[model samples]
Target: MVALRGVTRTVRLPDDQELHILRGVDLTVNSGDHTAVVGRSGCGKSTLLNLLGLLDVPTGGELTFLGTPVQHLRDSARARLRGEAVGFVFQQFNLLPGRSALDNVMTPLLYAGGKQFWRRREIAMDILDRVGLAHRARTMPTMLSGGEQQRVAIARALVRRPRLILADEPTGALDVDTGQTVMALLDTVATESGAALITITHDVNVAALARACYRLETGVLSAAAIPTGANA
Candidate 1:
């Protein structure tokens, strides 16, 4: 559902020097595919995720989503596409401070019109149930535990039935056991929904859960071998 060829991202520093974030990165993510990207803290994984999520444009090369070229799309068009086809889960859980869990999940439907928007409450409730957060629907973010908040975030991301999920350090703030549970839930939900999942993480165990894995270094992405008996 996504493709990138020789993609590059560069930004001008305060001193007029150019900072290259991604260099000729090539990647393709098909429907129902699970891919993992592992990299150090400053190796440009976030830049790659922004490009894949349609939140930013590449400085050079090509990017397409479901066969349509996206590098030249206007900001509004790109936002529309992202709303319709992509879901995002982040380490920070990005939930609006005062919104209830159900309301948070329903936020995406405001962009999805007609039946989806009209039935957003019902749909959001169902997704909350799927993520085991039905009872917490009325709860505020501060009232919930870290794992519960993340679960709500996942529910919000999946409520739109998006074709692609971009997760960045989804389990970074959780304990080991909670992280495992969250990852398993993410995998299960993506598979059940037939959405491609691209996870950005620094954890090797997290990367092992994907069918394909790559490590980013020096602004480059290269495939990494999964050890024998790896989960993927």
Candidate 2:
């Protein structure tokens, strides 16, 4: 569902030096696959996620989705592609403070399909139920707990039924038990929807849930073989 070839992103520092965030990164993800990107801060993990989501363009190399070269698309075209093909979950829930959980989750559907607008509420409710947040549907983000808010975010990400899911530090704000619950919910949603999932996390336990895992360090991405005792 996603591929990157020799992708490199560079930024100029005030010191007149170039900082290479991603260096010759080559990666691919297929339908029904789950990938975990493990790295410390400033290791280009989020940069890689942004590239996959088409939120940012790489300075060099090719990124393709469903066989289309994403780098060649126009800005409006890229936005349309993102709305149709991608969903994103972040460490911060990013819900509107005044909106109820149901309303927040339905926001994605508004940009998804014009004909599906009226049905967005129902779809949002279903996703909330799937994420075990049906009881909090009418609650506002401030009134909900951290885990609850993240669950609402997950519901929003799933409401569109996009082909791919990009999650960056999704469980970072929650406690251990809550993080585990949220991760499991994410895993279940991706499996049920048949959408390829890519998660960037610093936690080793969280990374173990994916079918394939990789670590980013020093401008390189390396794959790891799964062991029999990986965390579920």
TM-score versus the correct structure, for each prediction? 0.96, 0.94
Alpha-carbon runs more than 4 Å astray in model 2: 226-232
Q: How accurate is candidate 1 locally (lDDT)?
A: 0.92
Give candidate 1 regions above 4 Å deviation: 227-232
User: What would the per-residue lDDT of candidate 2 be over residues 1-232, giving only the tens digit for each residue?
Assistant: 8888999999999999999999999899999899998888989887888889988898999999999998789999999999888989999989999999999999988876566787888888988999888998999899999999998988888888889998899988998788888988899989989999999888876787789988899779988764333353
For candidate 2, the per-residue lDDT at 50 reads 82
- What is the number of residue pairs that collide in model 2? 0
**Candidate 1 — number of clashing residue pairs?**
0
Worst 10 residues of 1 by lDDT: 223-232
Q: Which pairs clash in model 2? A: none
Please report the candidate that would top lDDT against the real structure. 1
